[model samples]
Target: MDTMLTDIPGMATYLDDIIVMGSTERSFMGSTERSCQVLNRVLEYGFQLREEKCIFMHSTKYIGFISDKNGRRPDHANIEAIQNMPAPTDVPSLRSFMGLTSRCSTFLPGMHQARGPLNELLSKDKPW
Candidate 1:
């Protein structure tokens, strides 16, 4: 990974995602070009590039967050999923949905407070 960093300057790695920061400088003589060159080298060495997953220039998604020079924030997909999830009809379904949304509870203000009802449903005495 250090080799990747040294080779792909301006490229930041967070787990599986690789963020390639862009520059206004000319492509032939800029950090962006150099970054691309390094990426090519890494590809030659057997690393496969998933073009569909790659984001150049603009902000990119990493982990469960969206990141850029400005900073990182929770990804909108997390919000959308929570907002669009169907109202739970049973304990099992509610638990499953809660498990998924819990991953981003930090972004959900007062999530601890909201868990009370869900917890009641999860109690062993509550059957599916």
Candidate 2:
């Protein structure tokens, strides 16, 4: 499958799902065209695509984030979960919160600085 789509920019496949993306208006048009090329290639290779699962010209959720030309943001549901999380009262709980936050770190600015104090608590010598 990788070899099949390798020639198309901004195309990615995982298992059987394929996602096409473009980061700007210029590339978005190209992305649309490339999707057609993908469809033709799928036919050429005797693979079938479910039309119901296919989406076009819209920001779509992939992995844990939603992305568009403006770039990716953490999914709102994920953000809400993190926001509603109770403040961590112990090392283990803090670690849990940090782990979740780390998954969205790309959307967070100054993450290292923001987490400095919490990270200190995780140190062996810090004492619970």
TM-score of each: 0.51, 0.60
Name every residue pair that clashes in candidate 1.
none
CA lDDT, every model vs. true structure: 0.69, 0.82
Colliding pairs, model 2: none
TM-score, model 1 to reference = 0.51
Q: Candidate 2, after superposition: displacement of residue 59 in Å? A: 2.2
lDDT of candidate 2 over 1-128, digit per residue (tens): 76778788777776777777888767866756676898898898788988898787668887778888777689998888889999998898999999889989878789878898899999887876
Best of the candidates, TM-score: 2
The best candidate in terms of lDDT: 2
For model 1, how does the per-residue alpha-carbon lDDT over 19-77 read when each residue is reduced to its tens digit? 65644335323655675686676676667777797545556676677766655677888
TM-score of 2: 0.60
